[model samples]
Target: MKRTLVIGDIHGGLKALIQVLERAKVTTDDTLIFLGDYIDGWSESAQTIQYLIELSEKQECIFIKGNHDVWCEDYLRIGKANRTWLFHGGALTFEGYQQLSDEEKKKHLNFFERMKLYYVDDNNNLFIHAGYTSMKGPEQEFYKSNYNWDRTLWEMVLTMDKRVKKHSVLYPKRLKIYNEIYIGHTPTLYYNIETPMNAINVWNIDTGAAFTGKLTVLDVNTKQYWQSDNVNELYPNEKGRN
Candidate 1:
């Protein structure tokens, strides 16, 4: 059966990304929706982007832009690295790109340039790298950065009162618009949960591959998921945004 799989943040851990893909037995029949942050932490930041570029040739894939991706794209375009971004894993990503030729770098930059802020499916399923703030929908969002930086949507749902009904005015209008919302910027490991998390209709897939956490992939409809081993363990010699 064909399946739509939503993947968590990669943070440049290509090994873990490969592991979860294999663990989930992914095939061309599967549609992979990566929740971005494809680069920044691990040693394979550049290689991971190249891999994704190649992978798209074999299957249906949608790439959502994450905050880290923004940083990478900016560096590629302007040739100036942001100090704040470098402190948070951008250093390794930049170092990784040093190995690529000018032409390869240009190709990779094009790849980043094409990333989407958000994607909505025929079933009204929302897929975004981070959270959006607009109540109407991502399309009507006033602040475009919120698509790749907002955390309030996740936090609100995380703390939402369980007693509130979906139809109640007390319930969030944001949550009412979609059948389900999937995001990745906020890692589940931040809360000490090393797996995918679901709060109300929102699914948080980022398992923190940037730190000591695993990479994750979930079947959007069934909620059945697969995860990789701790990413730090895969590249012990490198400190991955820890």
Candidate 2:
């Protein structure tokens, strides 16, 4: 059995992320799959992206595109547009970029553009930056739609039941695709539940890392979970609002 480490959203909390990786004892032999949101939120967005890119070159690392990443790509690709980029934690991400040189910034932006939206292993486990709603069809379609989708569409998909909704056409019946779908986004608290879902074979690992949540990781084969101590207490003012 291949040992894979699935990581949750890392919203620029470089210190916290480093601790989690160290705790996981990541080795050259193991695969590290990041679910995205590598930038924005804390103070190390640029650094985090650089580190991940470096790691990718050294080992097998899968990078997925988070909503924030999409915004970053847009902001860099287009001269200007929606301020939503700045409003939705882009300010922090921009701040992180300030710490880097012009050349470094260009390099990171190039990397962000090349990230994949989702990763599906032969074993059946699906990895996506965020959970999908019923509106999309087929895994590939979901990936394409999500890359350019707006929040309203995403919300609609999340609110409706995948089985009965027209959008659910894209997703294979839960049992047919794989036993579990590992996803990020839609903070766990939005579900107002403790202990993230493992039922329907869906495991949400986001853990609200940007707010009063801890960054998380789980071993695919063993299902062993690990988390960083809640760093929210240290940044009380930035919780939820960020």
Q: Which model scores highest in TM-score?
A: 1
lDDT per residue (tens digit) for residues 1-242 in model 2: 45799988888877778777788887778898888887677766778888888888888988888888888777666535348877877887776666777677678779988888777887877787765543332353544655324233335435545566323655444334554677777667567642344534567777777776778878988988777766465455554235
lDDT of 1 at 201: 90
Compared with the true structure, the alpha-carbon lDDT of candidate 1 equals 0.93
Off by over 4 Å in 1: none
**How close to the true structure is residue 95 of candidate 2, measured as C-alpha lDDT?**
65
* Ten contiguous residues with the weakest lDDT in model 1: 130-139
Instruction: Go through the candidates in order and give each one's C-alpha lDDT.
Output: 0.93, 0.70
TM-score of each: 0.98, 0.81
Give Cα distance to truth, residue 85, candidate 1, Å. Answer: 1.3
The ten-residue window of minimal lDDT in model 2 covers 148-157
Candidate 1, residues 1-242, lDDT tens digits: the string is: 99999999999999999998999999999999999899999999998999999999999999999999999999988889999999999999989888889899899889999999899998999999888888898888999999999999999999988899899999899889999999999988789999999898999999999999999999998989999999999999998998
Enumerate residue pairs that collide in model 1: none
Taking every candidate in turn, the Cα RMSD to the unseen true structure, in Å, is 0.8, 4.4
Tell me the deviation in Å of residue 129 in model 2.
1.6
